[model samples]
Target: MKRVLITGGLGFVGSHLTDELMAKGCAVTIVDNLSSNVMTPADYPGCEVLVGSIEEVYPTLLETSKPFDEIFHLASVVGPAGVLQHAGVMAQSIVMSGEAVTRIALQHGSRLVLASTSEVYGRAGELRESDGCQVSSDVTVRLEYAVAKLTSEVAALNRAKVTELQVNVVRPFNIAGPRQLPDGGFVLPRFVVSALSGEPLTVFGDGSQVRAFTDVRDIVSGLQAVMSSGKNGLVLNLGNPANEITILDLAQRVRSLAASKSEITLVDPKALFGPLYDEGIERVPVVEQAFSELDWRPVVSVEQTILSTLDWYRRRLGLSQHESVGVAA
Candidate 1:
């Protein structure tokens, strides 16, 4: 069986990816600190679990982690909110983790895929991998996360240029699906959770701010496509144009789907937790690169994503029956 190593195998994206990889008959090795209350591999039996930090114990763990054919580096210190809380660790983790993963993957002759964020785009408009936009200096707190990810991306690319260790980077837009933490500050899942619990759906900045959402399933498919395409040294964006929805619309939709009479409240943008949390909007991928190269496109609709997310939250809240509620505007 082909063996794959995932650095943050217990996270929302990482856990789902682990499930996908294992279902393909690939032996999976997971390295996670479980800082996020990661779902255990007991939940996914037949996978190797190494509970530790990649930055601290990766070298030793990688040495014994067996012959990995591919390495998926998904662990990072900063989510949007975590970045604001631990700027220093976020910067350190990105750089150190990338460098360590690159070295280990190269030694094992393993192909590496680094998980990156659209936050690297900053306030830049219509970002593409080929597009040259400097990381925004306006948001000093967010700058650390952006710069650290960019640094890691550059390091991986440089390593791929010289070594046989195939390295590719994926810039994932806002991904929302089941298993996301409600307190983690991801908007869609939060909305679903709030509506399920009859809590106010808080919209920041009049809810006009827009974001693109990619289903975790779609992201897993995109990752598989990149691995098959042998698209080393390439940076690709994985997202759906249809996933673009305004914050207000998202809250309304969640409430409708859950059939909850939750009130929508707009909060001050400044109250948002991320460091340098400014209210703004961003679009999805440019489609041209993803379609031509990965032969991949998101087939799921925003409505489906919303419904699935609501179902997940409802299940989490132990609600048995879902009511028929019209889609709210």
Candidate 2:
């Protein structure tokens, strides 16, 4: 069995990835600072779990968890609120985490996959991996998240050229599904929670903002495929253009699905998130690369994602019927 380490392994996508790897008979070790996921070590009975940020616990990890066969680096400060909270230090934390993972992977000659965000593309529409990113301003906190992630990607790929560090980057577009926290500014979970709660589903701007939401399960599968892609310094886009929908339409769908009396409200984002938030343009990834290179294609429909998220949240809240709220903040 391949021995692997997943930073942020307890978080939404990472936790799902852990389940996948373990099911495949891989020995998995997971570390998370609990910044995003509420899961504890006890939550995962089979895998070894460590609780700390990548920068904080990597040293302990290096000395104790020797010779990892592969590393999945997904830990980073995330979301609009999180970015603004750690503004000046966000890039530093991200780059340091990348370097730490690179060193660990290099020491073991392990395959490494860095989970980069689609936000790096900034404004997007049917985006290819080759398209240049358009982060409006470095000073903007929202854009800073993208710029910082890109910096980490560049550093790792540059190292991959000369070193034995087997590394590739996967840019996932708008991941959504169970266990995704509303705290991270993820739209689908937020909408589902609000719809279940019979609260207004907030649609920022005109709600024409388009997004192609990829399910977390498919994303985890894609991440694993990258490790076997056998190409260093490769960058691939993982998304489902088939699931694309307008923000307003998404809100309406959620309401109908949940059978909620909640009004779909159009509100200024600034009114809710303050000035640091920038929603950017439509996110639509051209996923031909992931399909062509890894033989991977997103199979989950947008409606399935919504229904699954709603069900998960309902279960978490201990609700047998509709009405939900108190999602982790």
Candidate 3:
């Protein structure tokens, strides 16, 4: 059986990747600090989990957990809100996790797959894996997180070359799915929750900002595809290309899908993300490389992803909704 170690294995992308790996009969071990940003352990059972900061525990954990076939480094500071709220942790995690995982993978001869983000592209147009990450001098609140993730990617590549450890980088673009936190700033979840609750949707910047939303299922599948195909020392953009939707359009879809009569209100982007919001615009990925090299292309539609998320959130909320109705004679 193939053994894999996933850092931040309890997070949004990590949890989904864990499920996919388990489904493929891969033995998986998860290490997560579960900072206040997200919950711990999710609902998955029988997962080998180590609960501690990657900084404090990664060296020892890596030493003991050697001889792995592959390591998926998915831990990170995450979104703009995450960086802004936990700047210190973000910086530490970015540096510590990268060093620990890269060193361990090199020592154990484990093929490494690093999960990078399109946010590293910043305001760049039509992102490609060959296009090195864009750096901004602007005091964008999220700059620290982007810089850290980008640096980690470079570090992984350099380590790969020095140690002959096979490494692949996968930069995912705006993945959204069932487990997304409603209170989190992810636009889709926010809109879905607001629509479900009959509350007005908050559309930032006239809802014109465009973003690419891919399903977590597709992302996990893409990672498996890349690793299975024996592709190493390559960077792949794993994301859906056809589904670039505007915030207003996304809100409309949520309202229709949830069957809610909620109003869509426009909010200043500055109010949502502070004044630095206007610094740059993010664009979708060009996945031609993934197609030719790994035979991997996103199969899930944005609409399907949204509807699946809606169903999951609805059930999750229903369980916590009204009081139990059983035995009410």
Candidate 4:
């Protein structure tokens, strides 16, 4: 059995990754701060979940001499609203987690896969893996989070160059699906919940912003593909452009799919993000490299992902499905 360590293994992405890895017969240990997730070992049967920041747990982890075959670093201060709370500390958290995981992976000869963000591209479209992460001198929370994630990537690559540590960086664009909460200012979940509750789906900035929402299920599958493929020192953009849609269209789709009489209201984004928004123009990913290297491509459609998320919310909220959507968009 393959043994792996996942930092933030209980977060939205990390939790899905854990389910897949464990199903494939990999022994997975998780280190999550539980800032977003609230669960104990009873919630995740058969998985050892360590609840704390990586920095706080590093010393005890090293003392125990736990050897892992792979390390997946997915921990960070996420979402637009989430980063607003950590203006000065987001960059610090990114670097600290990067250093701890990089060192541990090096010590045990474990392959490393670091989760990054497409926010690093900064207002660019058709983002390729080779593009330099755009840096802004102004005070932008989104840019701060992006630069911090980029810093972590740089540090990991520097370490890989020296010790031959197999490092692959995954820059995911607009991810959504099960277990995602709207508290973090993620647009899709917020819209879905509002539509389901017979409330208006708020569209920030005329809902013109174009984003390609990749299902978390497909994203985790892409992560597994990166680990399975014998590649080293490569950066891959893992998202589906085929699922691209505008925010207004997304809201319309949600209202239509849920068969809700909810209205799609246009609201100023500043009202939502509270000076925490960056006007990024049409952020999409270039996934040719991921497909060529890992033989991976997202198979889930935007409509399918939306219905799947709606179904999850329905079950979680104790509401039955719409009774009309039978795997049909």
Candidate 5:
């Protein structure tokens, strides 16, 4: 079996990626600190689980002389709310962890795949990996996350230029599906959970904010394709532009699909995320590069993604699944 290492393999995205890698017959080893989304060794029965931060465990792995064939660097402080809540630690962790992983990949001659965020695009439209990112110097939580991710991207690319390391950076755009945490400032999960529990679905800022919600499964497939593309120093935007929907519409759709008597309420962003929170006006990725390079396109529709997410939450919460709710358009 091919040996692979994932830095944040227990995280929402990382965990899902781990399942995908294992299904492909790869021997997966996970390194996680269990600080954010906690998962135990029991969660991954067959895989090796190292319970420590990447910085703490990477050196020990190197000392073993068992080099990994591929490294997926997915460790970082995620979510705007979480980052803002712990800015100092988040900033330091992102930069330091990125440097350490890059060095480890170099030493092991491993193909490195870095998980970046769409937050680096700021308020730009039709976001592409080649387009220059636009971010303000405001010290806000969103900006902090974006800047740190951008810095990591630049560092990885620079390293790839000088070395034979194959580095591919992926900017995932609002990936949502089952296993996503509701309290992580992720809109889709929050909506699904609230609607399932018969609570009001909160829509911020008159709900005009548009987002292209990509399914996590599609994102995983895209990541795997990027790894096999044999392309070095390339940044690809993995998102489905066809799934673009406004916040209000999304909330309403979720309520309908869940067949719940929940109300859709509008709230101010400041009330939820504080004054420092500057919401992105719109986020839509230009995914032509992903299509051309990886021959990949997101096959899951937004409606199906929402229904599956709702079903997952219901099953986990011990609520009955709404079989009456048919597959969404």
Candidate 6:
């Protein structure tokens, strides 16, 4: 069996990827600090769960000569609100985690996959892996997260070039699905929970921002494919362009799907997330590379993703799904 190490394996994307790798019979070892994750080590029975940061546990792994064929570095302070609220801590975590994981990969000759965000593009249109990142120079909390991710990417690529390690970067678009928390300023989960609770679905800044939201399942599959067959030192944009939608449209869709007597309300970003928050106008990915390289394309529709997310929230909140709220045609 292949041995795999995942940092932040308890997180939203990490958890899903852990499930996928375990299903494939890989001996998965997860290192997580559980800062933002909800699942415990007990949740994954067969896998080894080390309850600590990558910086702390990776040295022990090296000392013990624990072999890892693959390492997925997904540990980072995610979400707009979370990053903005704790910019310094987030930046520090990224730097420490990136260094530790890259060193581990080099030591063990393991294929390394780093999880990046579309935020690196920073208000760009038709985002491709080749496009130069337009990170803001302004002293805003948003730039801290983007800069940290970019720094990690550069460090990983530099290591790959020098050490000849197999390394790939995946910049995922707005990935939405189960196990996402509403408190992180993620629009979809907040809307789903509000709609289910008969509260208004809040739309920020006129709700005109366009985002390409891919299902978590599709994103995880693409990550796996990249690790398996992707060329070394390649950066792939893994997202479904077909699922692009406006925030207002997303709120309306969630309200309709939940069949709740909830209002769709518009709120300013300043009021909701303070002055540090700035909205991106558009985040559409050009994913032809993923298809040509990995033979991967997202199969889940936006409606299906939204419905599945709603179902998950319903179960978690102990609310029964309304039979009358059928899938929109």
RMSD to true structure for each model, in Å = 2.6, 3.0, 4.0, 2.6, 2.7, 2.3
Question: Given candidate 2, what's the lDDT at residue 45?
Answer: 93
- By lDDT, the best candidate is 6
Q: Kindly give the stretch of ten consecutive residues in candidate 2 with the minimal lDDT sum.
A: 320-329
Candidate 6 at 308: error in angstroms? 0.4
lDDT of 1 at 77: 65
What's the C-alpha lDDT at position 180 in model 3? Answer: 78
Local distance difference test values of all predictions, in order? 0.78, 0.85, 0.76, 0.84, 0.84, 0.86
lDDT tens digits by residue: candidate 4, 1-329: 89889888888888888888888899989999988762455678798788899967876666556688988998888887778888887888888888888878877888999999888777568988877666878778777788888888888888888887889899999899978888778888888888778778898877888999999989999988888788888888999999989999999998888787777899987887777665675988888888889878799999988898888888776777783222233
lDDT per residue as tens, model 5, 1-329? 78899988998888989999999899999999887764567899989999888877778877657788888988887775666676666767787788878887888888888999998887668888778888786767778788888898998899788887679999999899988886667899888888887778888879988999999899888888888888898888999999999999999889898887778899986788887666687889999988888868898899999999988888887877783222223
Worst lDDT run of 10 residues, candidate 6, spans: 320-329
lDDT of 4 at 294: 88
Tell me how many clashing residue pairs each candidate has: 0, 0, 0, 0, 0, 0
Q: Candidate 2: which stretches are off by over 4 Å?
A: 321-329
Candidate closer to the true structure by lDDT (higher is better), 2 or 5: 2
Best by TM-score: 6
Residue pairs with colliding backbones in model 6 are: none
Worst 10 residues of 4 by lDDT: 320-329
**TM-score of predicted model 3?**
0.90
Model 2 Cα shift for residue 288 (angstroms) = 1.3
Compared with the true structure, what per-residue lDDT tens digits does model 1 show for residues 16-52? Answer: 8898988889999888887774487577668888888
- TM-score for each model: 0.93, 0.94, 0.90, 0.95, 0.95, 0.96
Arrange candidates by lDDT, descending: 6, 2, 5, 4, 1, 3
Against the true structure, candidate 3 has what lDDT?
0.76
lDDT (Cα) of model 5 = 0.84
RMSD of 1: 2.6
